[model samples]
Target: MLEVRRRGLTTLLGGTAVGWALAAHAQVPEKIPRLCFLTFDPGTLTSNRFGAFFEGLRDLGYANGQTISIDYLSVEGNGERFPALAEECLRLKADIIAVSTTPGAQAAIAATRTIPIIMIGLGDPVRTGLVGNLARPSGNITGLSLMVPEVATKRLGLLKDAIPGISQVLVLSYLADPIAPLQVKAMQEAAQPLGLTLQVHDIRTANDLPAAFDAAAREHAEALLTTSESIFVAQGQRVTELAARYKLPAMYCFSNDVVDFGGLMAYDVNYSRVIRRAASYVDRILKGAKVSDLPIEQPIKFEFSINLKAAKALGLTIPPGVLAIADKVIE
Candidate 1:
């Protein structure tokens, strides 16, 4: 009976060890997917445009630090640093790299053809050589493209309507932006039919802003316009303040939030919608959707907003027709 008890005890101990090993294996946590958000939107993860992206991800059952982890690396509107940042993301083994500019996308693509890239709210991606086809991208690059020429036509025509006798307009743009030439060309084409001339100033940095404004004043420019870019987005307040100081009724691009920055008028892509769409793209990519399978998208939503207070400060009256067409009017 003692021998029988010993054998039974051994069998029980062996079963207990096997159960413990199984329990430990079951407790192991699964690896979470990681994403890297690159480029600039005023250097904050909480920037309104970026917030829209995260909100989209949350709606799709993603939570930061839970199902997915994200690292926001802002290059502060400098594209030269994009490659290094892309390398860092590669080192982190990021599942996706989302960029805000065409140059940023280029950098990521150049860094690795294997990793996926999403470009957000940039000019014609095809013209920029980021992709061969929109319906079906050939490589690992895809996202949203803003129709630059169309936006230019709309902005110039609206500016003409909003500001009477606005023959000469000042344009402040970042010279290093990949799409700067395209923006200039589009604006020039748009201006020709309106009988307006564009006086463009290259604003390379913050210090260049004052000089650009002074040049505009010296050139007798009646109004101001700016290309949508990360640099301008970063300096939205400063640009609006200078426009106010110069009494230059301005029309802006990119986001209507600039109107809140004291800008007179803004006609822009609904970046929130575009970026939120991007979140769906991100989700699809995480779920094994190939970049080549997703087509580059265009901006479906646009916003035209006017700040009545800004117009009043400039001693200008907006036309009833213009106000009627606006999506938002800030009093």
Candidate 2:
């Protein structure tokens, strides 16, 4: 009878050990990292603009919803919504916040001091106080700089080249975007050397766009140059239509804007490439790298795209010199 009791006790002990092992296994949490993407452009989540980011993450062995999760918040051209959207990301306990544009970066920085922020396509982070310096951010923010001034100069040069004898140019900028003033200054500086006159027209909302176009017409602007602001990019189709309606040849910042949206020409960094590089920052941060250690990067390449159909619609001829150097020409 003692032997029987001993065997029963052994069995109970073995069962308890197995249960404990299972419980311990259940308690071991999965180490899936969470990323929050904050953008002023609403179409980022749904369009190919942000798809490049996911593709980059995949290249780094991170598959969304499987190995990692992403929470997206877009203000959709409403600058006032940025702070609240950033707070929402904080409430969700995001491990890292990836911000696109200066306004989104500003909102994210204001929302959390502990969470790491990866800024993409920001203009003059140092001037805007988003970072101490490009080499060492010294805070929880670092990624890619759009190098807005250089790009603006290049775009204006292309515009001058495409439309020789074009004297007056209208700059359509969003007044709400912090980067707008800097971009306008860069354009003005670029215009002076080329003997091109630039008139600044600030649009505060989508409703203000029509009035800005009317102002452009009243100024007798020869060509239109739109800033690379989220609000302006979000209204690309409208801007293109208005430029056509006003009979003004327009130059855009992104090649896709010209190739896809029917703008006259564009000279800027390939946004897809920049966003892809930004994903590397995310990967490093997830692997326990500090934001301050990761230095800010700038685009190594810029592309020029021209729409032949758009030029035709504007009754303009593309100089052979311009067409010869274009990376992409859409007919």
Candidate 3:
């Protein structure tokens, strides 16, 4: 009888160990939340934009596989694919959709009213009807905006001041871009007061850029100013290359392109800050703070960057006044 009791006790202990292991496994989260990243630009995992965002998420106690998984999609500068991509993310039942541009934001908004949508560097969300207001987004969409209109005006003035004798300025922009019309308006309004004539050229594709530069040259444009739009951002290297190849004194809106691709000067909002700021909104949503409760944040960090090499290539001199104010100067 004592031997029988010992065998029964061993069997009981074995069953208890198995049950405890199963319970422990069950207690842990079986399914991680899935995030969908949709962008009009080429969406590589290594893109600095995503890296910064992931770092921000890590700070919030969630890492890949442990808490969440991100499924990314890129349009590769093709607007036609955005709608389909957005719809697919919705069909995949993403917990949240993070979009990088206005077009992508609009696509996500149209795809679902239920899913929380976080925008990155969208231009004029209020004007575009992406959100009702900054303080209260009032919808499933909320995030950071691109440069303010007044900031755009100020950058143009600085460009003219830095490039003395720049009376006629060539403005490069995309006609189909969501920010183009507003930028053109700002350029026109700002140029008129400065006595600068704005020669606008619409570059719908890469092939059209050379012709646009030729037109700017034929018109005797003394300087060039490129606007910040999603397509232009994706083609930053190409834009800087064309500006150099054409030898037009140019200023870009993004410091990344200016520093990386050698533009003479750049004044714009800090992109990493924009991405990191959006991470806060994502955190709030996950913590049961409704997106509606979160206010759409504006850019608090702005920067001015100058490239001395590019300035020398155009035979332009960076004024001491501008140099003193620059946040970064690239040699």
Instruction: Give the per-residue lDDT of model 1 (tens digit) for 66-146.
Output: 899898887766667888988989998999989888778878888889888888767878887888989998788888888
State, as a TM-score between 0 and 1, how close model 1 is to the true structure.
Answer: 0.92
Clash count, one per candidate: 0, 0, 0
Which residue pairs overlap in candidate 2's backbone? none
Q: In what order do the candidates fall by lDDT, top score first? A: 2, 1, 3
- Per-residue CA lDDT of candidate 2, range 59-143, in tens? 9998878899888788877888989999999888899999888888888888898899998768778877788889999778999
Assess the local accuracy of residue 19 in candidate 3 as a C-alpha lDDT between 0 and 100: 97
Candidate 2 error regions (>4 Å): 1-21, 27-29, 43-48
Distance from true location, Cα of 241 in model 3, Å: 1.5
Relative to the unseen true structure, what is the C-alpha lDDT of residue 44 in candidate 1, on a scale of 0 to 100? 61
Could you tell me which residue pairs clash in candidate 3?
none
Assess every candidate by TM-score.
0.92, 0.91, 0.89
In order, what lDDT does every prediction score? 0.85, 0.85, 0.81
lDDT of 1 at 161: 90
Could you tell which candidate, 1 or 2, scores higher by TM-score?
1
